[model samples]
Target chain A: MTASSALPYQRLHVELDARRYPIHVGPGLLDDPDMLVPYLAGQQVMIVTSETVAPLYLERLKHALSGDGRDVREIVLPDGEHTKTLASVERIWDALLAAGFNRRCTLVALGGGVIGDMAGFAAACYQRGVAFVQVPTTLLSQVDSSVGGKTGVNHPRGKNMLGAFWQPRAVVIDTRTLTTLPARELSAGLAEVIKYGLIQDVDFIAWLEARMSALRALDADALTDAILRSCAIKAEIVAADETEQGQRALLNLGHTFGHAIESHQGYGNWLHGEAVGAGMLMAAALSQRLGWLEPDEVLRVEALIAHAGLPVTAPASMSGDDFLSIMRLDKKNIDARLRLVLLSRLGDACIHDATPSDMLDALLTDFPRR
Target chain B: MTASSALPYQRLHVELDARRYPIHVGPGLLDDPDMLVPYLAGQQVMIVTSETVAPLYLERLKHALSGDGRDVREIVLPDGEHTKTLASVERIWDALLAAGFNRRCTLVALGGGVIGDMAGFAAACYQRGVAFVQVPTTLLSQVDSSVGGKTGVNHPRGKNMLGAFWQPRAVVIDTRTLTTLPARELSAGLAEVIKYGLIQDVDFIAWLEARMSALRALDADALTDAILRSCAIKAEIVAADETEQGQRALLNLGHTFGHAIESHQGYGNWLHGEAVGAGMLMAAALSQRLGWLEPDEVLRVEALIAHAGLPVTAPASMSGDDFLSIMRLDKKNIDARLRLVLLSRLGDACIHDATPSDMLDALLTDFPRR
Candidate 1:
């Protein structure tokens, strides 16, 4: 499939004050190496990928990167969220040094969010920083993580506990990789897909309801359309608040609760998207309880998440108190104050300062048995 | 030793393209916390200092940091070149995440070069990249490491083999700290002092010879003046080539051969400054052998380094063949070609493409019976 043959897609630009980059979306786009040529002006290239995705796509990327007379090299890391650690980062640094990579080299991230984060970080530190390209493979990364340029590894105490907000030269998403994704992993990707609709686009939420079946079936047109729209919405929000200073906080609608669930459950016990699926349902319920959202709206969001094969309730082992304690350590918290992004309506949200009692009561109602 | 009572020192700035920063040198500078106020506008503050320096100065800094109602935290790592490693970085990330540090935070490196590099690397990774300040405690850091904004930990395979070129918001050099430095460490600092003279400051070299007695006696005024000048030359070179692009290569006059000597001798076997001291003499001999420098010029530089009580000869353990093999792994090499910075005259140097045979002969003659 060739990029030129695919349907035209919208281009969303993230305007960082000095370092600006564009996010391009469409079908069959990965095959077009010309789009990446402008950023690869240098001769040295280092591709960072993971074990699961490397064997499938690294060679193709190497060939595409070699188009501009650049010397191509690659470092393959272990797959899964567990690989996001200082130990893993050390491996990347060793590889770069062993290869004699300098500040002039370009680092290409060729896997999912973990690969993108770690690779982007390696580029950020290699000679202070080098150019980086994001080639997101997973659906979760394509819609969210790949767009913002937030890169780093996780600590045992929290998710994304350590990281930086360094932007990429360009982001390349190849929907072709989605064809090989397992059904369970594909369903996990829908969590972030649903997040975009719930935050700032009601019309898009309704659109997802109509096409959710097609997306789950991996229909090419439906999946591509969903991805392009998600990227466009994200690009707009990120451009306005690249560093998460203002409206960018809206993007974390369910992340505060989502991170708590992930942290309490022990990171890999549940995939990040799965936790977010359950977290969004909790946020909607809390919004209804707070009189900010209608009860019917809460039901609608929960139904969509359940229909998409995502968990709509907190993990059975986690008590209401456990969730509360974990959320306190969230990055959004200021001086131990718990700040949550709660829904005011399907397309509108606000960052609310929630009291400990209010949060405890809401949690008990959601996790009634506890 | 209040800043208000001291004579005003001239300021020199390092122009890093879009990100320019100033190098502040004077007595009692650290006591004036207002100097750090501009860079501390972020949400969280993590100060990376060493055990040796922390007990002596951390409280004074902590008091100053908390003045603006910002949340300031400190993490103290073991002191030494050996402490700069991946394991140490992991400890830093763990401490950062445990303290709830995020992208909006600024890491203040409060020790010598090792602390600055390790902390700077942590800041670079903690959330992709965050702002950091360099408060160099030792002369080596004040004159060399802190100014470049190059941050990273050492890999098991090599020194500074893993890191980034992330710049600092500001560099604070308090000459008062040098009063606490051990005589051995003070002499180690002189290694870099002689470096500026060997590279591109003949007049500075002549200046150093005239005041070697005062400097050896740790005269505060003379020491601060030398530090400011060394930084000025480095800032100019770094500004012209922030990433060692062109003339910045001159900074590595002794580094290539220095790194080989350090690696072969076992890192920590010789202080980095000590190896560079000897390495500078070897590079001078190699330059003379290549006819790029006169014999008299080599003797002058060698005499200055020896006068500072620094070793001017390589260790007996490092063989000529081993030195050549190790230097090839340096990032400065281009496609198996070894590049070395050679002095053309006092205060001027140029990078040359030296062949394996010429390099081997220089090493053999320079380190006979090795």
Candidate 2:
């Protein structure tokens, strides 16, 4: 057995009753096979990855997990948002069964958010809950989806419309994998990092405003600082309300509008974080119209989002009715009441339905160029 | 809405930390819309039922729920053990999306175990959980699957091999529904009624022994008494261990062996409880071989199961290897060790693995005749 001292990592614990687990953040986690052994309960392991990620780091992750005579098997799915379907989840179940998996088997989600969501869900229903570990490679996943354990596949009507709140046993965030991440993909991830600042922490927003250039340049220290802070904020929010009943809705600051955009534009046309980044500006403009945030603050939020290479404008062809129609089908809606999380000001957001429909209609038509 | 005080019903509250809800047991519950209204979160309600159940009671249930400007939608799936597939669940998702159902929409499972399981799982994953009420129609589901929060669809590998633990908002059990249940189906239901007595309460066992004929005859009083006691025992077991980590597993007394038989014979060929009934005899026989139960006691257990019109012998075609092969694939297996729930005495059963393999193999070969 390898000594524990060999693994250099920083641990952040997500405390949600019995579903509590750890998020280990650091470089060289792939070298520490011991990090995985303690969380796994059996010899059987299935590594679920995307075609985009498999050729890059699949073998190394497999090598890391093979330390304790583990029976490591894998299934590589087609890449992108299109792959997050029930058909793909069924294939995972098929692969696990073909390999003789049982309730004791552990599923290792070894890619970005799509792998984590689909694989985590596959584990949730496979034998009614098996252990699974997340190794999120993308910066967006490292900051948001990997730690909170909201695992689900996208539905045709809306994004993440069907799923379970299945938590993982552990999340291993190996920041070193970001080295090979495409520049645009990294910028898309910065959108979520920017979200953490716009929603909760102002000091962190100040930090990002100063160092976003370093983040774009793939500076290790800047990226680690961004990932660590974003995950910590999310961990606290998830711990408070794991099921999104009340306080947890704050995490969806731009998500309601973001999900609507993704569904309207089709899943792959715009990245999740890019939609979210643009959606945040819409929310900021609405918050300003509600007299909660000043117009200048809305401009600040917009400029920062644009600086991170995120789209700040909704598709010109999408009428107000298009936004209203998709938002009506949002999974977050309670009895068709379209509730959205909007900033009262920078660094604080609240789930509100008080925005007048005509005002929202006007904003959708023009979206405040100033 | 009709006054709740006018509705005749008995309430048993299921207490689990935050998931506390009630099971309303009565004769005329289907006549009272008020009983359903309190549990429902929104104006939108989706009733999920089997084809057999939809023809029998769907309109009646819908009429009862349609009061006070509610939007009631229905999804009628094919009725049978075979319909509990992930594909069927996706279709339910499709229906919900097509009808614009969201987080506040309540799912009403209006049939037997298959409907409760599949619908409950659909609720659990529909926007990461919506409120769901159980209106279990079959006697078996009324006494067992409906009471526990164990929800999932079956995989090809095994029965109920894929699922989640999602508690219903409320369970509406109407003993009147059992009147329409087929005669053979009634006998199959009695197997679970017999099981509760065998595993936990000897007094209940003695009670069933005296009144097995009346229960088989579908005597309303006998059936109500049986359902109440069985539900009470199950509620306590589930309350103590909602996830089946410890004491909750004792409730799965005959399920491990029963699942193996059902898998080998194909699901619909042997009714679930019929297989469980035969499985309980195997468990009792093994318990006797372990010197836990006397031979006379084993004979008595067999007699009671047989008296309930349940199959007491294994199929001659299934060799010992067949049971071993399927049992090895069981969801209850802990790291390759096949664990069985066996009787310690008439009133109690415990999870045991100490019985030698040769003894079990010998018994399966010749299920000893008296």
Candidate 3:
């Protein structure tokens, strides 16, 4: 279905000093001919997309970006979470250099998290960084990866081992594209939507409990509100701390546990948001054991993830020790201490590191891959 | 020869507000273990050196950096300009990740410009950027690349196509290392030293002309003075314009022509300073055509380069069009305009874009690589 003209957009400002830019969320924004023009710093533009997103949105994006005497180029790669890497970045570098795009050139990332990360990273280091605009097509990217300006590729040793904090000129998030998302992908996106409510907004949690089904059904109003609130919450946290120094770490409530799930299963076996959804349950369970959360709240967290069609348990192959080992590899670890973001109470998340290992091991026995 | 204990050290401050650091030029600094400890942010210290430098000073540096229960790792790359590439950067990234060096880890560069650029670039992107220290072993890097925050590696299509502007935490330049430098390389470095005079310091030009022989002979006092003055001049320029917006372009007086020379010959074929020396003459000739320079000044520029044992002419294989085409690819070029840093008069330089193409072509036919 084509985007409705009556649909509204929400604009949130990141306000990162000189790097501040607007995150525009709306329906039919992708079809807007001038959506990307203002953020561009030069006439030389390149769209870095994936095999999947290119076929779906490449023509529309190209049409909007071209016909202005602009020198536009495209570098397409196979789609996968595994492809968010330096090798892919090299291919992008080759394309930009072949087209003679200098520091002034602007790279438009027109796909999900992988594309945004790879393209943004290429821009960050190409001639010491070029301006970029993010046109995140996937729901997960719109609410999470594309907004915060944390761009990097994975290394064999760990996820996002090489990266830079490069802010985009603008985030042109077109929620209309969510209509094309697969069911699993759409549900995975809601995990982060649920994350916002879990971390800071009890009222939003109540709102999601009522309206999440509508969002799952692709209801325009519900989906738009979920995305808008998520972006606003994330923007507020990032504006206070752009580099994930303190408050920003709250946004990664489940990501530490999530990263291990992805790493243990290999990068693409379980999608990031799926792992995060399950990982959030683990955090909820941990918080309950610490007496920061009630047993019912933990059950609600797991039930909500399961309702969204996401896994709510770690893989059976992963022991508590295995999870502990991988978690220690996290860049956030200070002097080998495993620092985690756990909910101190439902609707209020906090970073915690004092949980006993024996308690964590005993807790893992309750939830298996099944 | 052993370094004299009585040689007084001089310090030059870069003075960039938040990026400010000191350039310390002295003798026997390698023996001082405390030199780098304060700048290091963590116990994890990695030394990135070259095949040529490893045998000479790596052990001294490693010994100094260790024995304090510090975690030190070494990644030795092959020496030369050819080593400055993404592949080299990957080796570094691999080593850092393998060693589990986080953002707080320090990367110490212990070679010439090539090593300094590669290590600095690695440090810039490893975990979004780690602090680095520069221990330049060559004259060129000591006075030029190591002082500024410019860090990057070369691409096949151009020089330094991928890079970042990551400043080192501190620069430790041990003048004693230069005593081991090849005579040809030492002379090549003088080209940049003379450039400081031609661009901003007239008195420095007169001083160099009077004492060029003493420096060439490796007279400790003369060499010490030239290196100190050159670092101070460069530190001042970088402080005023950290990222080549306006005044910094003057620092590239002959680099536009020189980069084309390096690219055409294949990087590491002709020495960077040798090409810059010759390129400086080309700029002087161009300036004379603009009626901004006298014939005698052009002759002196060429003669000074010749006296320093650097090339005074471009290669015969490259026609004027070749220079123009390659130079247009320079990062400084905007909207296809070929911006060049040309001498307006002796002891002064400015960026010029109005030089007629026909004139440049006519001038190129006069100089050829014999």
Candidate 1 vs. true structure, TM-score: 0.85
Write candidate 1's Cα lDDT for A127-240 as tens digits.
556789988888988988899878887776766766667789898777778987887778888988898899989999999899999999888778888988888888888888
What is the fraction of true interface contacts found in candidate 3?
0.71
- Between candidates 1 and 3, name the one with more favorable TM-score: 3
Give interface RMSD, every candidate, in order.
Answer: 2.9, 1.1, 1.0
Per model, state how many residue pairs clash: 14, 0, 3
Every model's DockQ:
0.39, 0.81, 0.70
Off by over 4 Å in 3: A1-8, B1-8, B367-370
**Please, what are the lDDT tens digits per residue for candidate 2 over residues B1-370?**
4654385678888888778999888786876876777899888999999989898899989988887789999999998989999889988999998998768889999999999999999998898889999999998899999998889888766678778999998999888898899877877888888888988999999999999988888787787788888899889989998888888888777777787788888899999988898989999988888889999998899899989888988776777788888887776777767789999999899998666888888877777422
lDDT of 2 by residue, A121-179 (tens): 99988888899999999998899889877899887566787778888999888889999
Q: Model 3: per-residue lDDT, tens digit, A1-370? A: 2243344677888888878899888887876655668889989999999898888999888877887799888889889978878999999999998887887899999999999999999999999989999999999999998888899998878889898889999998888899888998987888898899999998998888788778888888787788889999998998998877798999998899898888888888888899899989988988988889989888888887887888977898888778877888889876666788999887899988778887777776665665
DockQ order of candidates, top first: 2, 3, 1
Q: Please, what are the lDDT tens digits per residue for candidate 1 over residues B14-52?
A: 888667888888877777765676776376898889999
For model 3, what is the alpha-carbon lDDT of residue B300?
87
Which number leads on lDDT? 3
- Of 2 and 3, the candidate ahead on TM-score is 2
For model 3 chain B, where is the 10-residue window of minimal lDDT?
B1-10
Docking class of 2: high
Q: Docking quality tier of candidate 3? A: medium
Using DockQ as the yardstick, the better of models 1 and 2 is 2
* Candidate 3 lDDT: 0.87
